[model samples]
Target chain A: MEVEETRLPGIGLRHDLVTASGRRIGVVSQSTGARHVVLYDEVDPDAAAATVELTAEEADAVAELLGAPRITERLSRLREQVSGLATEGVPILPGSPYVGATLGDTALRTRTGASVVAVLRAGEAIASPRPDFRFQAGDRLIVVGTADGVARVRDLLRSP
Target chain B: MSDAARLLVELGAVVLGLGVLGRFAGRVGLSPVPLYLLAGLAFGTGGLVPLDAPEEFIEAGADVGVVLLLLVLGLEYTAGELVTNLRRQAPVGVLDLLLNGLPGAAFALLLGWGPTAAVAMFGVTAISSSGIVSKVLTDLGRLGNRETPAVLGVLVLEDLAMAGYLPVLTALVAASGGASAAASIAVALGVLALVLVVALRHGHVLDRAIGTGSDEVLLLSVLGLALLVAGGAEAVHVSAAVGAFLLGIALSGELVERLRPLLGPLRDLFAAVFFVFAGLSIDPNDLPAVLLPALGLAAVGVLTKVATGWVAGRRAGVGPAGRLRAGAALVPRGEFSLIIAGLVGGAVVPEFGATVAAYVLVLAVFGPLAPRLADPLARRLAVRAAERTAQQRAAP
Candidate 1:
């Protein structure tokens, strides 16, 4: 039996399924699929919800269109991978020497041993900052690499 | 017209005059706040026009203005941003606070004030210019740059310290005649915590409820909340600005985003009256006696803050050029210093209060000039440093 397709509002998802004794069976998901779909079973009613599936390309496209938890999760994973190749985070202070200098000008990677991957400023997430991004007096930098590299950057920034 | 109406009209005239003078001063590249104070002086006892009202009334109004200013400042607070800044600038901010505050307290003591008074005075001066520094950095298009964050970080820490300092000072002052300082402080803190929790937990609901009403109702509610919190703080032996700032912090973000535009005109209207009242309290004849000392103190205050800021900025890993820029950017002492001085000194030594007020007025007049000076100074320093580096390379 052919089942009717229903689109969820604002979610850009259409699902086709069969209702058998209050259970959704043989569910098919369709959309510009970047979203992850979860199936839940209700014990009280003994019914199964529609199954959701998306292609990898569709997942990315959906993420771009809808900024959801899944997209954030993916970004976090990517950041973690990059950070694994670098050092830990470095603390910056006002007037300590690193406040106004940029990554390229300071030659942070070459001089310090760690590469700066992200800068968090004023509650905003700045990911993968460019070499030209200047350091502010109160910026916290996430650096990745060897432990010594991280210490080196910290020392340079803190140097009087 | 009744006395109040007549007074209001006179106040309007004074504001208009100050506005004109401020505009003229702006044309000449001077800060307008100073000019407003001067205009106020002209309308006081020593000048041609005398609007003799009690000092307390004028002070009360100015106090409201200060609270409003802090309210705006608190609106800028973001938890995540503050944490990041603290991690970066805490070490340097602490050092600067210690270095500047110690010396300032000693200076005040040497000038014959008691230990408590001296300490309070030190707090007033140790904190750098938040509004001035932020404005200058933004104007130079450096706010988005890395150095801006550190400078902002230091200011944020200073503001937080000031928050704690004001209450401590108030408690000390209140306890002077053998009152219970600890109890007073505890009550104040308790009330503050309660207010914050309520604001945070129910602010959105309150906003929605009030927002759905007419504009007048929304305005009234906003004003009512501000006044209530401010009044509550005073009732609990705390400074009103502290209450307002706390309220602001709780109601900030999305709630503030919706309420600020509605509240803007009211703040401006009250703020305008506030400055005019501040000016009217200034006696013109006293200016001659206070002018030299006030200017001297103003210079000291500005120079000390700038030097301290630059030193702190450099230690934070800001480049030499950026450090100099940050230093110059911090030169203006505006509303906050004036409010603290007024609150602490007004009741104890009116003369000292007047002196500090005069100092602030002069600084405000000089405030706008800092940005003009900072950009050129930063550029020149950058060039000089670059040339020196090039020369060293060539010689090698």
Candidate 2:
């Protein structure tokens, strides 16, 4: 992935990433620790098509959306350190086995070595999600463990 | 009817008229400044039906409008940014002054308004409307453009320069010549420098004073603080606008941001009233004689302002298209110009205010629209230049 970064002299840093499908995603990290996730115009990349301001928590959630956690330096080391120990997001699609089920009901964290550490819903991060949290379709579960454990958790989530 | 009752009734009608006109402007996707000004003219003395009421209240409200406009503008940048921008953009700022200001001064002198009027009109033509330009940027969604920061730099420079310029002009226009005049001008400069230094150094005093709450107390405190400072400046014979601007520069961080949403609506309402008061002060009959001059100034205004943006944007390494956009963006002259014209009063040529009002009305309407109007033209020129470059490369 090619990400272009520029320092916005006196303001902060701006980073732009062009996804494989040619979607240009921009993130402006302010000096004040605020972040603006800007969607650029498809034709004119300079103009912002949309700008969504994110709180600290939501910005972390967005990091997960970008694939691996890439916000802080420790997170970057975690990406390499946990290589095959796969940290991945599994979506709770409609008609999936996990729909309407509680995290405790899944029992998959115990069954497989994968731990559901966080849940992303409605653009919010529920960090260290509780066992009692309800599983809803469109919920993105961020799981961390061995590849085998993550695969098993994915299967558990997909099967109705 | 009693005098008070008639005044209240007339004021009510005026407010209603402004509201309706503002709504219409919003519906049609235009700034309501010109419309509001025209409505003020209609309701003013020497118009079709002048309002027969106490206008003292409106006059005071208009003064508050100027202070708030500058204050909010100052709130847009931090004191540090102001200093850095002024230093970095000094050359462009000077060029902008020379290009845009020279014409107005020359025009005033050529029209035989004398050196004093020439100086006053120079201030009028030189300063761009930070208020109107900001609105236009937001409205056009050009806040993220490559050249916007450059445009903003130019505006900030103009504002900072105005802080000193207004005080000196106030002194000059107050008295044509005397040792007392020199003494007052020096005093004004000293006060301005003192405020700037205090703002730059001990601004945290203001920060702590403003507190964190975003309620009515915070609102009243902020408003009161501005008025107190503005009043103090006016007492010292400097423009109250400078006082408010300096105060805005002193307050920064989260407090400024929190104050914005609370102050936004109030700023708009009072700012509209301020424009109306300006229009009311001008007689309609004087506009015709000045209209031709106003038009000529507008034409000159475009060239000088565009040249300013070009120098600024090019120096900042912006492309031709972006530079052109910057130039057009700087075209509108609104609040500050009117305030300067107001300051001069009848000291200059009798029709000075009329000329300024007409000039501003022309530019205020034209300024915001200039960028959008220039976009396609700039793109075409850019495309042609790019084609030429490609042809040259192919031949080689």
Candidate 3:
């Protein structure tokens, strides 16, 4: 009998991808971009992963399962660059210009090299802030950028 | 008609007159609180429908109003927003309090009142007029600006400070009242803690319960919760207002949004009665004796609060217009001040009570007039500052 496959949203594979003997056949990696989710999979430990891009609808369904569409998008974006970036990991405070600025201000963009993808304020997520958004005093910014870029942005924000 | 019937008739008449006067005042851009107060004055000591009640009864009613107001205030909790608001306003709040309090205390001493009386008076004057400031800021469309959150934060701190000060001052006035003071403070802190913990933990549950399709249950439960907390506070010797305020803090954000439309009108009605009763408490005969002191205090209260607000605004990087607006906003004192004064009077010497009432009456009259003064002051200050900047630029 053919085993049923399970597909996850922003991240790729739908298959249990478990072998007949219960051996794992593949790992699915999901990442997000500005407007879409990129999904690809690793078939074997020694083999290069096969990249499978999912449509926006597929990504939204997976995002709903993950309970965080914004995080899903962010993870999908990161996964596009790195095939196996963990989706469930806690995001560290980004080194971005928005570190000190209120979540609503355009100053976040000016101050940090990275665009603020979202903000976690008072236990809720605020995504894609407008130019006039005031950065609250204690808001945590989630940003998207290169590792070095994230570091630079984080440094600027972390400075008193 | 008997006294009870006459009292009801007077109250109804006052309410009707107030509704008309309030509408006129709002149309003309004045606040309704002061109008209600003035209407109280007109109907009570200053005009025809003279309903002379004992000071104790009116004061008790005012006390109840204060408690209810505080309970309503408790329903407006925004702990989630407090960090941002507090961080922005801490410096301004501290500076405003000191700047206002020091001078006020000195001024009181100059009037030859003893040190204790002077300090209590300073507390009364140091309180920035919350009603006036909020109303004018809203009217000017500046309530959502960066400066406003800070100003409001400072006001919250001031309110908390006032809560701490009230019981201590009361105890100082009557040494035997120390136990009640401790009890009140303890209850206040305990209630605050309980409300915050519960709100933080089970806020979603409460939100869902409130949202469930039972309007009567929701109203009753909310009111019942407020009263229960208030009763607990009262049992421990804390003011009902403290409990109410804590409840308001807890109910802020989603809860406030849900409950305000339902409860706001009721709050206003009680508040109106509160002010009218405040008005009714005053005796026409005593007005002459208290008039000069009241006028002096009112003038000082308005000027000092404005000056301190201006200083705080400037320090917070507010522009000249903004500074002037802040100053104007701080001009009107309200129910809180009167309530504090009554507490102080009852706790200390009864004579001081009369003095505070006269001062509050004066504030009620002039508080609404402050915003009218602000528009011209702000424009004039802006023009003057701009001219000075232009002159300096031309000099170079």
Candidate 4:
């Protein structure tokens, strides 16, 4: 699980890692938000056997697909370990006050003392979204905190 | 024909000719610089069909080309990257300067050019073409290689050095007396430092000033600012190209990314003109006399450039094979050398332009081939390393 990070100067950054199966993978992230998943050739090691380019949005979608389950699983384990801690999935109805607004605009954590762990939109989970992440109608937010804090978050989302 | 119509026809034809040459270069997997230079020579004085109508326009376009070239070059890296790479690769950078620069200086001295021409030649040979090198790395899919960062570090350091070197060269070229040259150098260096501080500390203010969603507004402001600053720098006797470069450094963030595509085509057009103008300035007849000297210089330039990369790659902990790749990647010398030639303009030595033009033509054409040639040697080194590793395992 050790990744070597190399700065490409003008280009961007590249993170290279070797999997347990001995496959060398490199992800090149350009300054302009272009990404390339590079698989190295076993024979040459320095040469890329295959490189798949991804746009910024496609990269985010791929990350969301891979990230959702693991984050929720970790949260569920934390819930089991704590006595009063709760993790709840709160749905954003069509008329929620935060709908179509950024995650930061809601000020949900400051208002309710609950943290948003992830967002579930159209059955896809986006984990650990930044403040800039926008909320949409029909999106479900995963809130984690004390039971009271979680209840407050639910109420806050429903409030006009 | 009316004067305006004549200018339009000649300028249009020259640009169209350049476009055809560029396409040809692309098809043949070569840089268009040499081809553009050849085109310039073809239409220049004493050539097959000498052009007179658009001479003034070409001259002006060439000036803009140099500015835009430096500006775009400065935009390639942020100030942070420049500082970091310089910190890490300062030794390699110094080594690069000595190894690559001295040969050209020595060659110039041997040719009996004065100290000024020697200084000019030092730059012509020292700096590798970052544009060609990067494009080669990308085209070869070597951007993901272990040795690439080291290669890029060397290029960045060379570019930063140019920020300082260009002013010195420009001052020396402009000043008639040694004392005046010294004064000009001091003033240029002072202005350069001022620009650096502004670029580093108040870059955000500049970013704020020019940050706009509208492409047209952003493009016009950046270009106009670049030209204005370039003109101002020229007024102070600092090179206008350096002024454009300083403007580029003072800009950062996502706005630079937005400005790139808009500036790219414009830069390309002007840059092409600059290269052709470099060729146009030279007499092809003078090239024959300097060809021998240029070849000798080219031989020295290739070895020195590779040596530079070898040292840099080793410092970065790259393996022997990867070091060769790094060195090979650095062999091409292009626009910067021509910029030096353009500055020198045969003012120091009558044959300076032809010598540099011939030298660049040789290297730019053959430098890209260095990496391909190094592959076999690199493969052998890799095999030896694998064999040694296997032997070590058996010994244990």
Candidate 5:
């Protein structure tokens, strides 16, 4: 978990850490927002075995893909433990009335007895989003409740 | 041919020639600077074919080139990073100055070029080519090396030194009297200090002011402001390049990144023109005479730079091989060296221009290859150390 941070003067900052497998890996975050993933050579610790340059968008996608799935897996495990309890992902469409509004504005829990547990945006999970957590188009809200409550929450989200 | 038509034709040919030269340099894995100079020399006075482009156009372009070069250089770091590098590497930077600069000054004095030429030569030899060094690191996949930060630290310090040195040298070059020169240096330093303060504390305010607006508007404002400040600084006897550099430092935040791509092509074009202008100013005939001394200075330059890098790497706690790579990485003297020589104006010595041209030519071409020497050199040293240890064991 320990990482070494090195400032590259005019270039950028590099943060490298050694994995449990004895592999040294680093990400150089450049001033221009590009990221370079560097794997250090075992024979020569000073040199890199491989370097991958990623654009800002590509880096975001990589981060999202790496992070988002864990939340889904944990939630899916909980769903298996309870027979009546259910979870459904409801995405905010462009035409939805609450697209730009906060989660509080919907009051889905009061209306349908379903709780919005988390919001997934760009592969990042915002857990236990507060009332004021704003909704953006394409945000996937994880609603958890009884199967009927979850289906009603999804219908409400799709319409309003 | 009409003057306008002839100018267009000549300018078109020159631009195309530069493009070809640059491409060839790229293919050969060399900095295009030396090749640009060669192209300039070929078309300059007493070469294969004289360029018929208006003198004023090239002069103006070259002037803008220096400004853009300095501006872009300053934009590479924030004021905080500059301070951090200065704080951490001050000793190494000073060593770099003394070890590399003194040789050039001594050589100039030995050549009977006097104090002014010594000052000029000091700048020429002291600074490493950051452009070439950075490219070499990227090319060699050494950007992630342990010694790279140390190498880059040395370069940052050198650049900071140049910001201060250029203004003082400009004052010295312009003023004949000792009192006036001293006064001018004081003024230059005062302006420099004031600008640094503004860059550090009030940078965000300037950023907000200059950084807002569309790309076109931002580019125009920044470029216009640079020219205005450069002219103002020139009027006050500070180097115009320093003024542009100060402007770059003052404007920071997200704008710096955005401005980089917009200004990059502009910087490249003008920078090439600056190199060519430097070459055109030097006569090819004068090169032969100065070649010997320039070569001598270059050899000394290589050693001193290596020494400087060695010290820098050691300070950063790099091992022997990494230290050698660091040392070799600091050997090239490119744009800044030429800039110093150009600022010298050949008033100090008749051969100053030619000497610097040859010196830069040798170093710029050789600098890229110098890093390759690091591994072999390190192995040789290791062998010698092993031999000495074995001899000691045998004696006992």
Candidate 6:
């Protein structure tokens, strides 16, 4: 996916990402520690469909899931790798290979040993998703496991 | 002790005491500014222990502190950036002045401080502490929030307003009421415009003139130029602080980045002196008389500052939570307010400084904790509001 980021002057940087299905994801990155991810209306790209704002810690968690957490945090996580514990979020969008598929069909857990701890949809939390649980667009899957295992699940859900 | 010996001992003791108090404030997660003020009061005349030193020496050091405070503030933005912010956000700035400034002026008049004190109080109340606000934003890790830009915008305008305001305040204090005051104001306007034009047009020229060859040369040249400009401005009846600020504006860009490490410590040291000096001028006994009004003024300040921040954030389309956070970040008044109070010291009622000291003490303590407190406070308030609306709708 090609992501275009534009600096908004005194404001911040706005990153516009288009998924393969043409869904637009806009993330505004503040120079400090705040990042707001907005889903744009399909027809009116300027209109905000929804916005998920995150603080530094929360954003750092998502960044770790995206495989690009801050250097310091990454180093700390590496030092703590003895526990083989990690956490990240994967946004469910249209055209994602895992969308519309049941968790059982994806074989994500079998392949990566990572488990979907929760599926958050429209502000609703669905915990410990069953194998037959269906994934829908905009559902954020909270995957937890070792770093390598989490990466595998992210690849399965996020990448086209 | 001899005058020189007394001065040396008192000055050293005050600075050291301020250092200890500052560390305590830091440990307690509060701004050390109010503590510095309190320290000043303890050593001032008619206070707990009157300093035996010649007051002129501390006053001179305080002057330098004021210059450095405004100077470093100016260095944070390029002249171009300042101009752009001024043009776009002039309305918001005007709104801030009207909403925040009016209360101070009205309160002063009501107190019978007369117009002179009202003008001084107007300035003291109007400007938010760029120093405190910036520190809070950074400490809270809120620099990236949606409402941060709006907050910065207001700060820039307030600083720019100071460029025009300080000169007027100086002229007003000097001439009191007469044609000389008008003349002084005109001269200030001329000086201000000329400084702005030179800064915007020839800032790069200055950057080259004050070459960043080595830190040593850079420090001497930058400090030398600021002092020279500030002195010249004072000679011409323009405020020295404004002169230093304009010089900082001219030296903005890569120069500021280079000078930050060199100047940061010096600015801090002198700025501390400035706060202590303001405190030193006040009599602690006077605070008892003005404490009630000062508290009321602070209440007004808290409300107005929050309102200004919220309105500015809303204009920028930030959500309610972010808006509240921005408002919280803005509540504290620090260095600039002290500088204003110091400037108007004898020109206003003798107790005016005490009022300012009391007011600042409260805000400084409140400002640091605002960001931490804002989230829960905003949430609870918002929840209660929602419940009230729901009840109202369901009743009919």
Best by TM-score: 4
Model 4 stretches with alpha carbons more than 4 Å out: A74-107, A119-124, A128-141, A145-160
lDDT of 4 at B71: 91
lDDT of 3 by residue, B169-272 (tens): 54454445557656655655565567667765666666666565566776778877777777775555455666667666656445565676677676777777
Query: Would candidate 6 be rated incorrect, acceptable, medium or high by CAPRI criteria?
Result: incorrect
lDDT per residue for candidate 5 within B234-294, as digits (tens), equals 7777889889888888888789889999999999999988988888887798889989988
Ranking by lDDT: 4, 5, 2, 6, 1, 3
- RMSD (Å) of each candidate, 1 decimal: 22.3, 7.1, 19.3, 3.4, 6.7, 13.9
For all predictions in the order shown, the interface RMSD in Å is 24.3, 4.4, 24.1, 1.8, 3.2, 7.9
- Residue-level lDDT tens digits of model 6 in A1-160: 7877554333357777778897777777754447877776553333345777799899867765674324334434654765768777778887777778998898888899988877778865566689999989899887778889999887767676
Write model 1 residue lDDT over A110-146, tens digit each, in one string. Answer: 8866777677677554667898998887788877667
- Model 3 chain B, poorest ten-residue lDDT window? B141-150
Give lDDT tens digits, candidate 4, residues B1-396.
999999899889999999999899888888888899899998889987798988878989999998998898888778888898888889999999999999999998988998999999999999999888998887777878878899999888888899899889999999999999999999999999999988988999999988965999999999999999999887776788889988888888888899889999999999999988988888887889989889988998888888888888778886777888899999999999998998878679798988899999999999878998999898887677667767998995
Please, what are the lDDT tens digits per residue for candidate 2 over residues B119-143? 8989989999987786787577555
Better of 1 and 2 by TM-score: 2
lDDT score of residue A51 within candidate 3: 30
TM-score of each: 0.64, 0.79, 0.62, 0.90, 0.84, 0.71
Q: List the residue pairs that clash in candidate 4.
A: none
Write candidate 5's Cα lDDT for A1-160 as tens digits. 8998999977888898989997888888888888888887664555566888899999988876776668788899999988899998989998889888998989889999999999999977987889999999999999999999999988887774
Candidate 2 clash pair list: none
Regions more than 4 Å wrong, model 1: A1-160, B1-5, B52-60, B139-141, B189-216, B374-377, B387-396
- Name every residue pair that clashes in candidate 6: none
Candidate DockQ scores, in order: 0.01, 0.14, 0.02, 0.50, 0.33, 0.03
Candidate 4 chain A vs. true chain A: TM-score?
0.64
Residue B82 error for model 3, in Å? 2.9
Q: Write the per-residue lDDT of candidate 2 for residues A7-103, one digit (tens) a residue.
A: 4433456787888997777777765567877786554444456877788788987676764333233333675886677777889998886788999
